[model samples]
Target: MALLQLVLVLCAWWRPSAPAALPAHAINGTSPAASATVSDSRVRQERSVLTNYGGSVGLSPYFADLQGRPSPTPPTLTTELTPPPPKCMDEETCNPLARYRTISGRCNNLQSPHHGTPGQAMHTLLPQRYDSPAVFRMRAVGGGLLPNPRHVSLLMSLAPEGAKVEGNSLFVQMGQFIDHDFSITTTVREMTPGGKSVEVDCTACSSWYNPACAPIPVPLNDPYQPPHLPTGERRCLPMTRSVGYLVKDSQGRPVLSQPNFNTAFLDVSPVYGSNRCTAEDLRLHRDGMLESDENHLLTKRPADDFPLCFTEAGYCLHSGDKRVNENVGLTSIPHWSDERLYQEARRINIAQFQNFVYGEYVPLLLGYHTAAKMQLMPNHEGYFLGYDPTIDPGVYNEFSTAAFRMGHSQVPKYITFMNDKYEVTYHIPLHYAFFNNTMLALGNVFDPLVRGLLGVSMRPTDLKLVDSLGNKLFMEKGDPHSGRDLFALNVARGRDHGLAPYVEYLKMCGVKEEVSSFADLESLMRPESLALLARAYEDVRDIDLFSGGLAEVPLPGSLIGDRFWFESPAAGFTHAQLQSIRRVTLASVICGVLDQRNPRIPVHALQTPHPQSNPERRCSELLTVDLELWRETPHSPSPPCTHQGQSYQEGALVPVSPCLACVCQPGGKMRCQCDLSGCKQTQAAEDCYCRRICGYSTPHLKPQYRQ
Candidate 1:
């Protein structure tokens, strides 16, 4: 009955519910209830009635009698009645983190690949069935270790000169490019019987049995809805939640995973998936040297597997990836004329995408020595170093909700683009990146002036003084309201994700010294930063991972702080595979994009000699690819691959990121293990024994004691 009442409320969100035979409820203007009822002309009148009458509580006079009087505040809510869960005693009878503690990582997983199936699942890619959530001594809030906005804030304090220091925006773009994979979630929208839309606010829906996950008629709101679509009609923006597959897995299977998207490569699917459409449009000619402006796309040609963007037609034309499909706003940027704007950006963006992970980002973040052992570098590709069919490939709770979020600090306050003499240009606030198509059409960030600081060498936008434009995330057209408290949210999200506190990760990461109170962080972080953390949280154990990590300065050369670096290769990766990932740089990805002669794209701009020497060069000119090689050749497969009927792009150059490494068990059959440990046979290695020595333990987990 309670479940039915919940459904009834959800139904009311679309329209007022009536008996099955009523078909059209004056209460909700023709809602199908659970049925797929379409909206009709009555929607507008109904909305008007709703607007003029009672906010959400309003109903037409015709149904006022049917609507029950407000049930007086349902008695103090019985003090949450749900019993305080059993404590985390010896893993055998512990609860899932969400139930055991606060509402964190429990519901954070991507909506399962089986989304829209009989039941939508949102389980962890790396599920630790045994539970003992991280314990916190103080109630956690968003900005654990930073100065409270009540006193001093980072963005408000950033000076003009400090804000202007440029980093390799290429890596920044790459970070966003890859972020699309890890941070994807769709706004679930519900149609009003009157054709109006209501964003579903699922805060009231409990995580374990969230009615929000139910086909409940609640629409989820998103920041990118208004502009991504060519039609400009608001579309539900579901970021691609697909496990990234480079090629076939170690088991020779099509490396599949859950809550993921169709795109398995590192192409610019954020805007274009190399998907092109129409003949007489500029398709890369097969001669490895010209354009096929008039010919039809081949059935199994490279265009089929790695399609070019029909950016000339418009940004919305033929984006192959699903993300563009979600946010049509990404398509249709007015600047995409002569295809120069979108196409040129693509060339540089993709080169950087491959380059960042392959050439510098990975090695710097993971540490060169560690990366080499994991075989994450391009040179390790042939030795069976980086493929494991069993790896979850799902983003981690700590990584996603907290650790990786450190990038927020690096966001700049402004973005600059060039037109002429650097004279015909626009230097706009970075938040304008989210501005309307007209402003974005003016070429906001595709220039070469903003290229070095985003690399490893430049300082992270100090956590205390993060850029306002990028951090606020959602701003109304030109509104300057720095709305969302991102750091506070990151801190909150970690708790929501049920991630352990900084100390737990520290212990597991093999930090021999103790971090008992917030004061202990003083040695590793800015004293001011520690003071800020002390203000928000009462106990040191209460410090959230993201806040704590951000507050601490990174290792001598690493991009992320020590916790994220240690947590990055969690038990899921093999040593060789980790090596390969560590060795990965933007260069490897650039090299693999072609089967022909390469372009002079520098994998890392900072690494290239005297980048300041060519500050005036266009991003397109600095990074390059042989467009001619991408042209479809006469000798190319006429009908494409045997599986062309599937409509899924089958082959394209995908630089490997870390993936699972599975080996044949004693039975000589393949078995999938999601442990982040390298090879288990070698028991004495550092990562293998580090957890136990540090006092964290999981029975089945060999490498990390935190199973």
Candidate 2:
């Protein structure tokens, strides 16, 4: 009973504990100090507790045990939230090839004439189509080489335009795939067989230009240097021959300096021979020129294939080949239904001009009489033949029709005429290849047609590949290097419908099999590259500024995986390779692709202004005025530039000195103060005197006194 009573007492006491109390005085607020004392006491107590037990980890065993007890429910584990991967960089969101397809779509969206808008009407154009299945099986082909249905139709219109397609017995369609609309009008005052010269107007001639193309004046000023004499007198003198060709220097004057006549250095050589012309055959091909008389020369016959002979001097009478039809007999080819006077005239003129300029002087000066000898085929087409007797089998300087489309000015009649005929050649593919070669041979610069064909987002030097997944396939190296092999590599992968036709062309050229794999594709395409490389001018090899202007297409970095950013050989960039790439355009690109598909295809440049019977005599006559002028007045020495305090003698560059007119002594500041009167002087007066010794006081010696 007592224990029970005690337990009850303990329970009642444990029910609640009394709160810590302040002093009675502090509670009653008797004295402010007393209240402060109570507060201080509390503060001391808290400080002691904190100081005695460093931190939670350093707490006493009792506190540790109290906190260490496990919770009824286990603690839940937590994880970090992460973000999703970035969207594919390329629009197509797949690979480089996929990206290219997307880019192509976007390019089409850019809306240009070449791209053609949706619903745009296309004419029914079905030109002749030729194919060679032996060389190509038609797998992995791209649209680069083959013309789209639209393009194919356009090529067919050449038939009505009076053009002929012929080669290796292949009935190919005639017409340029991408020629400028041009017109060439030649009014030749010809000496008729009746001993009377008649002026004939040949306006219906076909050329790279539109029939409406108007003649523009050609600035006759020398492209290399200013005329030694006054402009008028310069025009009067005969053209200056290449210095190396001359036995004596400029007539009476001693050769100031012999020019580097090393054609080897210039990289000019016959296509069939050595630079030295060592072999008799090579010598013949080197000296002689390719002169076509009758369209029969177009025959694939071995005899007609034989190159004509020529002399060291520019002449057409060198080779006595009997099969020559134009000069000998005006016979037509078996297929040609009509001997169109226009076509005949054009062929004659081209052949004649080639014969005329074979070894003749390439006038160094512009507008000189000898300048007439320079029948620069305005466009790349036809050949330059030497007619001289000693050298047989003349050199054939072939060019591309694309060349004819470039450069605007008064194209010489001879060039204009040759351009017309070459353009009409049915062997467009092969002719084009030759034309491209010829331009390089002529040291002519290639001007690409720029129309933002590629988007502005990409540069011309941008490396691009077709990502199979629709992502831009960029190169690993990036920038300029991208253009390096991208052209060749992509060309290797890309295909077009026209590829089969191209293969057929190769078969015609004696190629056994069509390009099969990328390796074979590269091998087939290598010739064109080699051709371009062969023609590469060492002088212009520094492709700095020229390459910077080419159009580039951005590609994905990698072909596989989600990362579009590529770092590969395709991405490599360099200024030199880019310069070469810049020379590429849709037309050139198309041509290259076509060449890969069909090796040795020809694309012809038009030959305008038909050659006459005696191109040599006429060319010589053209130089009469200039030659007489040179005889009248030789080049005089340049006058010396005289100026005060500076001596600029003849043949020396003009001197340019900074204004050092201010006079300073010792550590004095170099101040330039002009006279107010002189500041208002005319420019001429200032140039004559003010900028020289006119202004500034001489430094006066400081007075020194001995101590």
lDDT against the true structure, per candidate, is 0.33, 0.19
lDDT of 2 by residue, 528-631 (tens): 33222212211111111111111111122210000110111111111222122222221222122111222221221111122351111111122111111111
* lDDT computed for candidate 2: 0.19
For every candidate in turn, the CA RMSD to the true structure comes to 20.2, 43.8
Give a tens-digit lDDT track for model 1, residues 120-170. Answer: 122332321111111111123332221222111222222222222224444
- Number of the top TM-score candidate: 1
How well does candidate 1 score on lDDT at residue 152?
18
Question: What value does the lDDT take at residue 667 in candidate 1?
Answer: 18
Please report the TM-score between candidate 1 and the true structure: 0.46
Cα deviation at 239, candidate 2, in Å, is 43
Off by over 4 Å in 2: 1-279, 282-546, 551-707
